[model samples]
Target: MHRIVIAFLLSSLSGLAFAHGMSAEDQARILNAGLLEYMQLGATHMLSGYDHLLFLFGVVFFLTRFKDILKFITAFTVGHSITLIVATLLEISANYYLIDAVIALTVCYKAFDNLDGFKRYFQMSSPNLTWMVFAFGLIHGFGLSTRLQQLPLGTDGLVLKILSFNVGVELGQIVALSIMLVILAGWRKTASFERFSKASNIGLMLFGGLLLLMQLHGYQHTQFPDEFPLNTDDHFHIHEDMEAETSPLTNYPNKLNFDDIYSQDEVLHDDNSYQDEHSHDGEDFHSH
Candidate 1:
């Protein structure tokens, strides 16, 4: 059972590992990418977003009715869509690591709620689940916006691009939810699932906490940029030093530029000597 939980986490995080970079090809595609391509990109991003998936999973973990699932999912969708489109259009930027860290905590929050942690530990009624999901959906949308803005979304047809992306996001959500529903269906049939449901939520909570810690670690490195040696321009400096040490390109022994090859006095003397040589050559040619 623990092995199953670990395998699930590893699979989800693998996609997350490549989520943000927006490869050179992806960036180029965004410049001229059509509605369909933008839509595909959106779907791809949502599918790869493990935090979003985990939160959705936590939300639906106990939901048995289709109508309830739709209602909750719709609320989440509306909340995120409002923020995703508005924040993106307004070009509102936030620190991505901080935003993502909050998103990670959202998963933990949901899992904790699923496990009745609030009632057990805090001795308080849990907040309205619907409203809370919607609110966190807004935050999740902002996180999506941050990632989208990394692309060179052109000024023209911006609204269309955003809409297409949103459409793709919905498609991706549907695909992911379908799979979760199938799995949940199969698992709910088993006696083990009844016994391990709490353990499963606990696993979710732990994974979410792990993700949160990773994001915070990233945030700290971002805040103190100097500590991360890889970010510094040390590589360029080293290349320059290597050239200076081992290459004549830095010294330019064969450089043709006047400033590099000739002193002012050398230029003047060369000019005078050239005239003298020309006079001597002319005399010799006439005499011959």
Candidate 2:
């Protein structure tokens, strides 16, 4: 049991690195990709999205009836699909890191709800689960939209492209939920599940917190690169090396070469020098 728990934690942590970022190869390929190719990319994104999967897991963890499952899932599906399509079509955008951070919170929210944390700690009933799930689903879809916008989604057939991708996302969700339901149904028959359900939800919450911190860390690095001791170029290289070492599940023949993406001169400017160059109202404008 201990080994199984350890393995699950390790697997979840490893998945954090590969959560829904497009590689250079992906960007290049999508330049002329057809609807089917777009569908494939969407499915791939959903499958690789660990935060999304974790939230879904928490949503279905307590659902025993097929009708209940169907109702909740349909709500989530409609919610996400609405944002994914509309956001992509309108080119609505936000920082992907920040969006992912909120998605992480959604994961934490679901787990907390599952464990009845509100009632236990606050002596109050939780919000309506189905409505909350739907709201979180909207946020999750926006997260997906942020990633989708990274691709070269041409304007010629943009609507079709978005719809195709949304379809793929649904297909991927169906596959993932099918697997989750099967595992949960089988586990429900065992005594261990009753013994361990609370522990599992707690673990889910911990994982979500970890992901939240990681996303915020990434946001800081990207948005405030000059604040770090190492320049952005060096930091990116360190990340590249770390990814190479840690991610055994993925094979990146065409690894993301940040050299093509980041300009060293632009990112390597000293903070003091930058402050010296720019001032606001006769005072140094310092970044905090």
Candidate 3:
């Protein structure tokens, strides 16, 4: 049991690095992908989305009745689906790091609610949990939309692509929920569960807090790249090098060209900088 716990912790820590971002290879492969491929991508995203899974776990932690489970889960599904489809279709977006930070908070919120923190600490009742779950689901869907936008989603068949991805997310959620329910059901029968449920929720909160901090740290790096000792270009290159070192396809002859990806990004950044500089110069001349 100790070994299992340690192993799980190690895996989770490592997974944090790759969470919520697709690899360059994945992006490249999906450039001209069809609906089936989009569905696969969506399924893969949900499976790897630890924050989403944690929130779902907290939601169903104490729910034993199938009716209650179906109701809450359906509410969550409808909520996220509405945002996921609408946001992506309208091309509405925000900083993904910030969105994910909020999502991490949702995980913490659910876990805290699970522990009856409101009644214990504040002598008050918790808010309507079903409504809260639905609200958080909207935020979660926006987070998903942000990630999906990173791909080259073409205008052709856009609605179909989005629907396919949403369907895949539901499928992935079903699979994850089944496994969680089975585990919870078995654990509930054990004496250890009575002793450890509180501890488990506390652990969930800690994990959520950790994820929140990491996302904020990433946001800092992205928004204030100049504050770091390394220039933005150098920092990104270092990241690319690290990815290459860790990638299993490092020696593969047909590996995707990460340099090309960076080069394209550099071009776009330079163009934006050029336009901004000229615009500022124009304003200065007019002011004078």
lDDT of each: 0.86, 0.86, 0.85
lDDT of 3 by residue, 166-250 (tens): 9989988998789788778877887777777787778878988999999999899889977776877988999999999999877
lDDT of 1 by residue, 125-238 (tens): 999999999999999999989888989998999999999999999999999899887778777777877788998888888888988998898898889977777644878888
Residue-level error in angstroms, candidate 1, position 74 = 0.6
Model 3 CA deviation exceeding 4 Å by range? 1-14, 231-288
Per-candidate TM-scores read 0.78, 0.78, 0.77
What does candidate 2 score on TM? Answer: 0.78
TM-score of 3: 0.77
Worst 10 residues of 2 by lDDT: 1-10
Which lDDT tens digits does candidate 2 get at residues 1-288?
433543544665688766568888899999989999989988988888889888998999899999999988988998999899999999999999999999999999989999999999999999987898889889999999999999888789889999999999998888878877777877788788888889888999999999999999999988997787797798999999899889975676768768855765556655435554445676865542
Worst 10 residues of 1 by lDDT: 279-288
